[model samples]
Target: MRLKLAFLMSAVLAAGCGWSGADATTESGGGTIEYWLWDSGQQPGYQKCADSFAKQNPGLNVHISQYGWDVYWSKLTAGFIADTAPDVFTDHLAKFAQFVDLGVLRPLDELAPTADINDGDYQEGLAELWKGQDGKRYGSPKDWDTIAMFYNPGALRAAGFSPDDLSDLSWNPRDGGTFEKMIAHLTVDKNGVRGDEPGFDKNNVSQYGLGSDGAGGGGWGQTQWSAFAGSAGWQVTDRNPWGTRFNLDQPAFQDTLTWYFGLARKGYMPSFAEIGGNNPVGPDKQIQSGLAAIALDGSWKISTFQNLTDTSGQKLKVGIAPTPIGPSGKRASMFNGLADSVTSLSKQPDNAAKWVKFMSGEECQNIIGESGIVFPARPSGTEKAIAFNKDKRQLDVTPFTDQVKDKTTFLFPVTTNAADITALLQPRMDAVYIGESPVSSLTTVNDQLNDLFKVAQ
Candidate 1:
């Protein structure tokens, strides 16, 4: 059942099916441009920039529409099939190669202001990360984010440790390490049971040290799992960007999974079944309900965490940390970037290009950064973003942004059939997390993934 739902969502992320049709059209005038996006939270931010663009191009009108991520993709795929796709649309690194291969998206180099699109000005390695296999840049960056360890301050204090102690800690898969020790310490139970305690009850625990389900969701795309993959020095593919290969066969990959899932097996973290409900998007119910201490989450969770009030409307205190460095001697993470791509089918290519360029430009990025929802893609915009969040409850987010500087930052896998590979892999991964299966699932996952790449070849 879990596998079926995961595959269904993967199709939505891959092709965008079964949604209301996109009937919104750009104004007939040379002035109006159509724009589409998935984030409602970002609509206001985009509107601010659209207003600015309207002022500058007085004759031009910007039309913006919001769609749920699933619906957004479905509508987008429908638009492409009908040749009525939006003039400008948000894009992502995971699926950009397929669009590039189909020749539907306009390469940014063909548009105006090419000189201002300085890849060097952006964070090291990130701008280049958005370029497609056709050797053309499809979109300039809007913002960037990396995974970090978010914890409860009170929980850490009660465990006889200060958050400061973990400020520069690292991890590896030896007998025991700083990271494992911390997880054990942070884990507590009402009857004097801790993860390291001899008689710790894996079945009946009070507060789990960590909170997480297995990896891969549309929002963050399998949070903890990807980090584990990176720490193991695994890449989803080697040849073409669209090729799929599984790293699960490696000792490092298996080792990382064992260590990560150990948190659950040892009663330090919630079981996979405990968190992923009929709809996996729920409040990691354990963490939100305060039954768990630390959970793997994204930067955007800051707002949800802030607004999450108990029955009495009290806010939770959250602290942030850089992902733990692994045996590879480096901190690693899976970084996914979304791009704005113009459809080849658009009748108003000129207007579409302008909208795409403007939204991905510095001004638009600044507006989004100012809202504190995400970090601006440009390195220069970091200060403004930090200032915007300086007064907010989620302070010290600088480290989250700072990790982007680490050389090991990686973009998510991109394969023509990646959607299919992820679909096949996710549920098997879920089974592994639930302890319903073993390392053998790796063989099935790898074979399925490789089959997609074979078809691509």
Candidate 2:
């Protein structure tokens, strides 16, 4: 057990941009640590953390910039090549592999206090995700998210079932499964039609049981493919980022893709063709408009959905559950997380490390937790964070909280090209779902990706 634990810790230590000697500079007051983050939702909470941090280190300046997720990564990559990256910035586990290879960010091990930070202080899976290709830790754990099944109570009632019946329903790719039945039952038509009806008229259907917003269709896996792909033991890349090989052509992967599209064909889900384009159809819209009974998404959307007020200002009674299991007998999720890493060219290494440690600490996490903005990356901190949300916000985030246990699975790739491949594949995936071509159309996507990996090799 100790050896396994040690290996896990080593993996965590391996993924990020390690601290550099360039990070060494004395804080003589008036040094600014530019911080870039994606969650505008957490700005209020994180601003509080910043204020507390500023109070603790009066000489340091924190410049926090918030960007939408898509823009943030693009900008960060540009900054890296230009040597203008932030002194300390937020990073995603999925994006870490790419940045680590660029050697633009600093590793956390050099900055972390040996006595305070060890393998056990974090959730091992999250730790592993933050490790870089050189076997060095690039980012320190901040928060983690898992996929959940969010459904509308009203929609379920209309479908002749309640949240309870669907709560524990199991799933597999085969037909006539419990999950399939609930999905079919939850689907309804504007003319009071259900998907199971013979003349269901899928073209004119009013509501669907599941939604896979065309955002993650063709070669893209994060939002759509990654979640379902995991249930079938499909990985975006082998364990090492530098050793990537596309697995999309593999049988396990093809099976998942076929099954996912099958849901669309059966009228149990919204056909990519039905959604009309690649634009995302937000979860709140699906539930509020009575267009979908259930949607697979993250807990981060919980508060947003709860706070959404319609034209009549009515709110839906929604509940969340873990992502369903597959033939492999495991509940899979696309684990996404963020971390704080130092810049290799920072003017003040010591101060930067201090900032990184402070932000990644339980105190900061406790603050983020109370706001119900995100779960802390540390295991102990996460529990307290969830409990805090329950007591302070009167929101039960336990469904997302409990799913982070051994039951959860994450998509980890072996190469920095993972992000590049994902970007190229999304549009093609969108093509597949929109009926632009068949599933085999994605064959070129995998082929090109395999070629990219070979070049990197």
TM-score of each: 0.86, 0.86
- For candidate 1, lDDT tens digit of each residue in 100-135? 777888877876754257777666666776677666
Per-residue lDDT of candidate 2, residues 92-210 (tens digit): 66566766676777777776442245556777667666767666778877887777777777777766786678556766656736777888877877787788876777766788888
After superposing candidate 2 on the true structure, give the runs of residues whose Cα lies further than 4 Å from its correct spot: 1-29, 81-84, 112-116, 215-220, 240-243, 273-276, 392-394
User: Candidate 2: deviation at residue 296, Å?
Assistant: 0.2
Candidate closest to the true structure, highest lDDT: 2
RMSD of 2: 12.9
